[model samples]
Target: MGDVIPAPEAPRIPIIDNDEAAARRFPVRRIYCVGRNFADHAREMGAAAPAGKADRGLPTFFLKPADTIVVDGQVPYPPGTTELHHEVELVVALGADAPPGELAPERAGALVYGYALGLDLTRRDLQAAAKAKGLPWDTGKSFDFAAPVGALVPAAALGDLAGRSIALAVNGEIRQHASLDDLIWSVPEILHELSKLYALRAGDLVFMGTPAGVGPLRPGDSFQATLDGLPPLSGRILPALA
Candidate 1:
């Protein structure tokens, strides 16, 4: 018989709605994200920093490691900045591995395992500073506790959400409201494009992108996000570390 090898440790995250069980059922690999995938949001960031001439066409991309996920836990306000912002988004979790190639839109839907409400916490000040210097925003975007995800609802239950409404509220005020159809690039296109760059595997998550109207947050502030017919997911903002 061949020599025995130990199994690898599981990546930990707060799992709700049998996600842990589901995760065991379907192993996850990595996380991919598309930046400024909405026209309004693109305009907002573009207006903040004009990229050469006019800003039009093509969305930016970014990545967040899988281990950064924190679910229903205290989000420690990262050090080095006071301008921490929140960008709520609809998260797509993949179920099976897809080879890097031209993935048809239909095949794209086949990869989805479930959906979740997630927060793309950002260090706005650092992000702006990086943008001014033409640097990557990973410092602001990929920090620990930067991604907080909620329970997963199986794709079968939600069906196709291409045109569903997604909204987020702070305290009681609506901060963001838009249909998934508003996305500059559809989910399938995103998956296909991403697949070309990276092989997507089961458990991989993609935070499609956020809409306009992103702003700062502070301790004691609570927020809620909802996607169409799914139940709302809520979390409180934490103060900056001293």
Candidate 2:
């Protein structure tokens, strides 16, 4: 046999159950996202064309590189114009890579490591500017500290998350509410499609999208996201930089 190729390395994050512990470390990689999976959200974001137009087509996909993760306990709002927004979501941690194409629900479950609450922060003004120019959403959606994730809960501890309730609240006011079952494109389907384009690997995380009610944020503001059976994930938004 000739020389063998080395297997690709799996991304990894430190496993912590408390915020204090999580703050001391840096994330292994960052996989940012958008929550266009919800119909109401699609409409709110103008992604849904008029009823008969094209139905907004399909679930849109965008990406942010690995370093965008803000693991330092607090999310520092980026500088510039005011409109910063927050979208809470349920994060899926993969334990192993899945093959491309249609995957059985069971296979998808087997690949999961655990779940956590995550925030997909957006710079609304920048995003709008990009949209107006027909440019990609990178400036608006993939800013530094844009993806703030909570601790991992390990799959063995949290079983099939389908049909579970996921919600988020800001300063005691509920902003986003929905069920995992409401995802237009289910998790397995997402993984299948994503794998076809990029090899699915352990340590890779998916935001799985967010529900409607996405809006702006200001410094000193605090929020919390809760899944039916998981502990509530909370964070405080730091003032925007000068």
Residue runs of model 2 more than 4 Å from their true location after superposition: 1-27, 30-34, 49-57, 100-106
Cα lDDT tens digits for candidate 1, 182-226: 877777878888877777788798998999888877888888888
lDDT tens per residue, model 2, 25-61: 3234437354587777778888753343244355567
TM-score of each: 0.85, 0.82
Residue 81, candidate 2: Cα error in Å is 3.0
Candidate 1 weakest ten by summed lDDT: 48-57
Supply candidate 1's per-residue lDDT for 11.
52
Whole-model lDDT per candidate:
0.78, 0.73
Candidate 2, pairs of clashing residues: 30-66, 113-155
